[model samples]
Target: MTLLTVTGLTKSYAGADGELPVLAGIDLDIHEGEIVALLGKSGSGKSTLLRCLAGLIPPSSGTITYRGRPFKGANPGTTMVFQTFALLPWLTVQQNVEVGLETRGLPAAARREAALTAIDLIGLDGFESAYPKELSGGMRQRVGFARALVVEPDILLMDEPFSALDVLTAENLRGELLELWDSGTFPTKAIVVVTHNIEEAVLMADRVIVLGGRPYGSIRAAYDIPLTRPRDRDVPEFSKLIDTIYRTMTGRADTPHPPHGLRQPAKRTPANTPLPAASVDGLSGLAEILQRHDGHLDFAELTDELSLEVDDLLPLTDALELLGFAAVKGSQITLTDQGLAYSAADVQTSKQIFATAAIEVPLVHFITTSLRNSVDGSLRAGFFRDVLAHHYTSEQVTQQLDAATGWGRYAELYTYDTRHEEYHLDTVPS
Candidate 1:
């Protein structure tokens, strides 16, 4: 049975120039007896979709139905577990767990009983009387779980619930949750989790839905997990699935099963090819690592060796790709000749190489050309920000400018005066 159905969902927020779309034409269904993981990088609208399902935010357009009924406000059949734990600092664990019940008008005694039961089930029975400050990160998250579960809604929504915890703690919590789920004592009929961690999604979800970032947030692909519970990460099938997901997320066009959504434009622009939030040092460090590995490295092995999540590493790789320094095919990242030279060159030579390569990046090119054309070899930052405002939200404009500023400064293409908010052409020779 389908617990939730979303059709042609579109969500947008007010931006400087106009409405900025966050999610577009999202079509999804949350069925009973399945854990669906919404996986995507930052800005993919995973959390936005989850909030839409929870009815915390209204969609700009489209329909959401719960058990065949139109969803109007707070979803009666859903409760959310947040990444931040969101517990009242002054409240005891039991009181925090009972919050939803209190709002639902359950009698005090009954709420207490239910909260205790949930606390016990989530391995926090002894912590019920303790304040949130008295608990560790894992235990606080357990309280968050208990609080959400105490409501016993038909659908449970989690927004990066494990992201705030340490690796061992998160692993342990995931195991405990799965054990409870397998024991058939878990209250919810369905679970929807938002995450950027690909492995976490593969490990915990019965179905994984990948969301794309470019153009807007929309489902790129959905895969059903056939592996049984307690999946082995070391197995070949697991590794293969992870690799496939990596390829999909990285937008490998030749990937066997192409995702169903907007393809990145053949012509790159500042709007479409926004600079990845990576620094010069970060991308250069990765290139040096690739140089050490003979100009190529399997994506998975590099991620493991660096002990970084896919989200953490992707920005660096994206930056390298944007700068024409690297290429990613399937699960392999190969450093290009430009990348090799940049990695091997001395400081001054490397900056020159980077400047030449960075100019190919649309935003960087735009900034450099605009500065060069200026009568005084300078322009106010507001001029560029206003030009970009048409294509991005205010926050996005800031990020774009910041990225461009960093690259321009490092390449000596331009120098930004923090106080004056201006960009000046670098007169010094490389």
Candidate 2:
């Protein structure tokens, strides 16, 4: 049975220029007896979708029905577990767990009994009287779980619940939760988790939904997990699924192909193809590694060797691809001839190559050209920010500018004066 139904959901936030769309034309259903994971890169609207389902924020357009009834306000049938372990610092664990019950107007004695039961269920029985400050990170998160579970809602919504915890602690908590879930003693009938960790999603979700696109707020694909309970990460099927998800996330339909020993410059505008948040050093390091590996490596193996999550590596890979220094095709990244030379070249030689490549990037090109066109070969930083504001949020505009600044400085294309808030074309020959 479907516990929650969402159709044609669209959410937008008021921005400086106009309304910025987040989730667009999203259709989803949360069924009973299932754990659904919403997986995506940052800004993919995973948390926004969760908030819409929880009725914490109203969708700009769409219908959300809980058990066939449209949500009028906050959905009483769902409770949230936050990443930050949002426990009241002054409140004892017991009081924190009782908060939802108190709001529901349950009698004090009944609320206390329910809170204790939840605390015991989550393995925090002894910590009930302790304050959040007295507990470790894991212990505090356990309290967060108990607090959410004490409400006994039909569905539990988790927003990166394990992201802030230590790896071992997160693994232990995940195992305990799964054990409880398998035992059929879990308080919620359905679980919805929003996470960027592909392995974590594969481990816990019965179904995984991938979200992507500009602003990364649209559903791109979905897969049903067929693995049985107590999954083993070492299994071939597990690794295969991870690879498939990686390809999906990085795959671009319009990826350019080099021809005649020259890289094809992207025709996209800066707004459409925003620079990936990666540093010159990071992408350069990855290129050197690829060169050492004979210009190719399995994506998953590379991630394992670096001890980095997929999210950590994606930005670097994206930057490499954007600069025409590397190519990714279905779980394998191969360094191009240019990439090999860039890795082997001396600092000055590499800068010349990078400068040529960077100009092909729309944002970098826009900056260089704008500075060159100016009468004094200089322009205020606000000019670029104002141009980008139509397409990105204020925070996003800052990030884009930062990425461009790093690339421009490394390529000797332009220089930004922090004190004067200006960009000068002193390095580039007119």
Candidate 3:
């Protein structure tokens, strides 16, 4: 049965100057008896869409319907589990689970039974009275699950819930949830989970939807996970799916930044673009790893070895390419002479060589030139902000500036004073 339907969904935020569209022309549907995983990088609209589905926020344009009725507020019989445990510290596990019941004016006796049942279902029966602070991270999350399940929600929305847990714990929790879900012990009709982990998405969901790049994104692709429950991650098909997503998300290594997905603006990350957060050290580390395999490591091999998602891997590679250290083509990474050299260089030599390449970036050059020409060799960082605002969204501009700042700071091309938001020439020689 169709549980929820979204049509022509568009959402925007009012920026200082105008409406900044986060999601546009998005249409989606959720059905009964399926777990849907929303996957994307940091800026993608997965969370925003989740919020919209939960009715926590209204879409700027579009309609979301629940059971064929227009959804105006929080969807009935729905609850959310957050990435953070979000358990009230003062409330014991049972009390925490009972809070929702209390809000519904359920009698004390009924609330206790419902909360206890949920607690036992979530394996927290023994910890019924344990405070959140006294519990391990995993147990605290179990309390979060118990609290949500106590309401017997029709649809459960999970926002990176397992991201905060340790690897083993998360795996264990996943196993437990699947076991209960498959055995008819858990009763939720449907679920939506937001995650960055590719393996996790493929392992748990009936469908995996890519939210794509932002400040513009929505339902770029939906992949069906046809594998059976308790899918083997080491199986060829599973491993192939992981690599396919990596390539799809990151694009051909030879392709420039923002290589694939929703947007197709430019071949390279233009000077005005906000580079995703990455570092010279990270670039070197990837380069070193690639070099160890003779600079011909395929995308799948590299990601498996490093355990990096497309979002985590692509930006770092973009930074390296932007700085002339590497070249990416298809699924392979080839180190430039500079990349190999940087990998082998002593600390000082690496930074010095990097300084020369870093200055070649247009934004970095602009900062250095502007600071060099200033009366006191300084310029307000806001001045750079003005330049970026014209080219990108306000939030993206901030990210761009951060990337620019990190590059400048490392190269000693300029110094940034966070307290004053000023970019001044570094007095220390490079």
Candidate 4:
């Protein structure tokens, strides 16, 4: 039943000071005909673990066995789908799907048929000839998926394949994928997904694997996603599961305030305390930590507070530095006043954390900033789609926003407004 088993897997990279370990003493077992979801913060080694499982990178120490044999490297039947669509620009959809089949060396006619079947299976019946540029974000991702499917891999590896997609498109694709899996088509015997979305994991995966910080991608916890097939997010059980997972990841207490069952007011800290000029700009780890806690937070007390081991905290802390919330002054972490304000601001107590308008601040700020500074008016449409689709990297998002807002480069991209369900532009910079 164990299709893939990894034991004591360790990986490291050379750093300025020493060998920086990225993954350490990791252990995992994936069964046949199951989907395993890997959850973590952005740089929590989810991608590295996925690469290791796919044999894209060899671990420094450990044994990986697939179906009881050593997993030395990528096999003919193992396929991966990356967050970026990674399609050939010049190739049509059909051609891109067929590209994987080149190694099979089947006759042209046979290959064409196989490619067509894959395209259809992924719901791209009429899009076979469209180029990557012409296809929408969702459609292009499907083409990447079709490419993976054509190879008939035993295990499919997905590194946030839907993360770049807009919510509606991503939801639609998730539904279609589940239907395909249910129907026993598409060729993958098992699947493993690396994702930051807990709801997606709960809905799609049979098992959820939580990866904790860097120096080693260690398992913080593994929970069986007990919801039945065709789960509905509107249901109470579904909401409960999401809430639990969120609490587990961020070391937050279950139900910060008593009995807010489904809906609760957003928590905003009183503007007291001297607000320090941010050591750096942008959302910090404090934001992530506070979001995990549903906005009721304690600084200094919560750092290194995760259930995951000490080795798993470094990269997370390092990333916090980029967000301007985490600073190391001689082995001590000091949270800037901005970090505290952002973390303690109007966050709703709803079970659906992501569904709240407060959740839209960062995203809206990101989008608005881009639109304000764009040189070409036409690029706005594509750029908007990219944000909705979730295709671009954080760097890409910031770059576009910076480019769009050429006037005031230091505009505060987000703010809390109770009347608006999402962050509204405080004032369009004149």
Q: What is the C-alpha lDDT of each candidate?
A: 0.87, 0.87, 0.79, 0.64
Q: Per-candidate TM vs. native? A: 0.79, 0.78, 0.78, 0.64
Q: What is the C-alpha RMSD of each candidate to the true structure, in Å?
A: 4.9, 6.2, 5.3, 13.7
- Residue lDDT tens for model 2, 94-113: 99999999999999999999
Candidate 1, residue 247: Cα displacement in angstroms equals: 2.6
Residue-level lDDT tens digits of model 1 in 238-300? 988888887788764532221234232446567656888888989999999999999989877
For all candidates, the clash counts are: 0, 0, 6, 16
Residue-level lDDT tens digits of model 3 in 1-430? 9988989887765443455556777788999999999987665678878989999989887799888899668888579998888888988889999998999999999999999999999888789878998999999998888888889988999989998999899999988988888888786999899987777889999999877644466666678888998898889999788777766655532222331232333222333234657876677788778878886677777777888666578778777777788887767778889888887788889889889998878778878888877888888988888876755656668887888888888888888899999888987324
lDDT of 4: 0.64
Error of 4 at 126 (Å): 1.7
Candidate 1 to native Cα RMSD, angstroms: 4.9
Per-residue error at 156 for model 3, in Å? 0.5
Which one wins by lDDT: 3 or 4? 3
Candidate 1 clashing pairs, residues 3+ apart or interchain: none
lDDT of 4 by residue, 100-155 (tens): 78877888898899999898889899998889999899999999999998878889
Q: With candidate 3 superimposed using the best TM-score fit, by how many Å does residue 342's alpha carbon deviate from the native?
A: 6.3
